[model samples]
Target: MKRLFILIAVGLMSTAAFSQTKTDGVHIYNPEANAMADLKAATEKAAKANKHVLVQVGGNWCTWCIAFHQLVDTTVVLKQAINENYEYVLVNWDKDHHNDEAMKYLGFPNRFGYPVFVVLDGKGKVLHIENSSYLETDEPGANGKKKVGHDVKKISSFLKGWTVAAVNPETYKSK
Candidate 1:
C-alpha cells in the first residue's frame, strides 16, 4: 500500500511538471496574439505620442529574440532610447501561426530572418528593416569559444538613427 501511494505521488508530480509551459523572461511572444491588431494599436499610440513604432518580428521559441528582449529590458540606455523614440511591439511568427497579414504589412521583414526589426513611422510607414544579425556581437565565452548576442551600443545607435527627430527635415537644417 505504501509503495503504491509513493508511485502515484511521483507520477502526479511528473505529469504536472510535463504539463507546465515555458514562462520565463524569454517567452515574450504569444502565438495566440493578433499581430495585425497589435501593430495597429502600437502605431496609434505612437502617432499620439509623436514617436515611431519599433516592431520586433519573431516567435517565443526563438532564443535570439528572447535574448534581445532581455538585453533591452535590463539595459538602461537601450530601454530609455526605445521609450523616448518608439512604441515597441513584438509580433509572434511561428510554425502554427504565420501572422500573414502583419508580415505583409511589415513588407515581409522576416525575409531577413527571425528576430528581425521593422521601424515604422507614426503613420505605419516602413522606415527601415533591420536584420538582427547585424546587431549581434561575437564575444569569447567562458568556454573560450565565440558566443553571439546583441550589442548594446549598436542597438542604441540604431534606435537613435530612426527616431522622429533624427528623420525630421528641420533637424538637418543648417543652424
Candidate 2:
C-alpha cells in the first residue's frame, strides 16, 4: 500500500486512470550511441522538443537504482508527467565493465554514488542534479543522502506543474 506511491513506471492511461497501454514503462534506452554522442543527440532531441531530459546514473547492481525504478514504475502521475514533458536516459555506471572516465565526463569529476540523477535539456545542458542521499539529513558519515520521503509527492507535483492541465489532488476522490 505505502509502496505504491513510489512508482516510477506507469503506462499512459486515460486521465480517468482506467486503462493504459503496455509501453508505459520508460523505454530506458541503451548505448543509443557512443556515450558522449548519445548524450549530445539526446540533448539535441530534448532541445528541439523544448523539454527536459532526465539522465539516471546507475546500472543493474545499484540498490537505490532498483528502488528508484520501482518507485518510478508505480508513480502514475510522475510517469504521466514524464511522458508529457521529459525525455529520460540512463547512464550506466557499470563498475566491473568500467565506464569511469565517461561518468566523470557526465558529471562527477571525482565520482558520484549510485542513483545520481542528472537532468538535462535539449541542448545537452544540465537543468538539475539530484545526487544527494535518501535521507537528506546529517548522519555519521556516508554523506547523508537526501531524503526521498516526500520526494514521491514532489516528483509528481514537479511533473504536473510542468504540464498544461495539472492534476488536482482531490479529483481522485472517487478512488
For all predicted structures, in order, the TM-scores are 0.83, 0.58
Off by over 4 Å in 2: 1-33, 132-150, 157-175
| Cα displacement (Å) at residue 165, model 1 | 0.8
lDDT of each: 0.92, 0.58
Question: Would you give me the overall lDDT of model 1?
Answer: 0.92
User: Every model's Cα RMSD, please?
Assistant: 6.5, 15.9
Who wins the TM-score comparison?
A: 1
lDDT of 2 by residue, 1-175 (tens): 5455434234333333764223334334343335666677777877777677767777665556666666777878767767667777777655454456556666662155776766665666555566535323333345566443325765564555433233235645766
Task: Compose the digit string of candidate 1's lDDT tens values, residues 1-175.
Answer: 9999999999999999999655355668989998889999999999999999999999888878888998999999999999989999999999999999999999999999989999999999999999999898777889998777988888988999999999999998998
Name model 1 segments beyond 4 Å from true. 1-26, 142-145
lDDT at position 29, candidate 1: 92
